[model samples]
Target: MPHIIIEHSASLDTDFSQLLKSIHQSTIDTNLFDASTIKTRRVAFPQCILGDGKTDFVHVQVHLLAGRTQTQKQHLSESLLNTLRTLLSDSVSLSVHPYDLDPAIYRKN
Candidate 1:
């Protein structure tokens, strides 16, 4: 399972719903996880200070069950970053971080 969370500055203008759909689809294209298990959400911060206080940013964090190869994780992150690059403006600071959940401790009810 993978949970994708997008955190962005509120000033950033974009369609979050469409972004989620595109991200979900990109995850599916990887053939790494079940389509039904992919989850995506967004959070916007109304106030934040960035470099010079003028730059807006979008950060995507992806959490997944452990045990995937490093290459796979990198691929996942890069795929998402590429997707963001296409949907967002070049002026926006974008980043993607892929985190691994320990299989022994991670659980779902």
Candidate 2:
């Protein structure tokens, strides 16, 4: 079970919707989380203050119900970023965070 939260500035283009869809697909392809359990949220950043230089800064927080090996996390991270870069403009910035669940809770019995 992995949940992804996306926050972007209001100035960001509407194309971001497509980007989110792509992210969802990529996550499903990874087989890291149940597609049905994946939770996503997109929020518009306040425009009063200038955004952090880019149309938006994306923070991808992944919560893995099953503990992942280091290699698995690395591969997932790389794949996620690559997919994001392909969908977003070069000017946009992206950040990803992968969290591994505690073995006690995540290990498959």
Candidate 3:
């Protein structure tokens, strides 16, 4: 399974739900996993908490089951980042990070 967790500034007034759908579709297009197995959620922060007050940011963390090649991971990151940039305003800083989930430690029912 691949879970996409997005964190963005609460001040952002973007169409967040559409953004989530685009991300989900991008992952599905890779054909590495079934559409049913892809999950996405977004969290908005009240403040940057660790950055300059005037700066807005959108950060996406993609967690996938282990065994994907490096190329797959990079494409996943790029696809999501491109989607984010297109949907968000130029004032917002964006970033994407891909992580491997350890099957031995991850649990789902």
Highest lDDT model number: 1
> Among all windows of ten consecutive residues in candidate 2, which has the lowest summed lDDT?
47-56
Overall lDDT per candidate, in order of appearance: 0.89, 0.72, 0.87
Ranking of candidates on TM-score, top first: 1, 3, 2
List all candidate RMSDs to the true structure: 1.4, 4.0, 1.6
Off by over 4 Å in 1: 52-54
How much is 92 displaced in model 2, in angstroms? 0.9
Cα deviation in Å at residue 26, candidate 3? Answer: 1.3
1-109, model 2: which lDDT tens digit per residue? 6767666666766587787897778788887767898876677777534356655566576777665878888777777788878877777677777876665756442
For each of the candidates, give the backbone clash count: 0, 0, 0
TM-score (all chains, Cα) for each model: 0.92, 0.75, 0.91
Instruction: Give model 1's clash tally.
Output: 0
Clashing pairs in 3: none
- Per-residue C-alpha lDDT of model 1 across residues 45-108, encoded as one tens digit per residue: 9988888445788889999998899999999989999999999988888899999999899989
TM-score of 3: 0.91
Candidate 2, residue 65: lDDT: 60
**Candidate 3: stretches off by over 4 Å:** 49-54
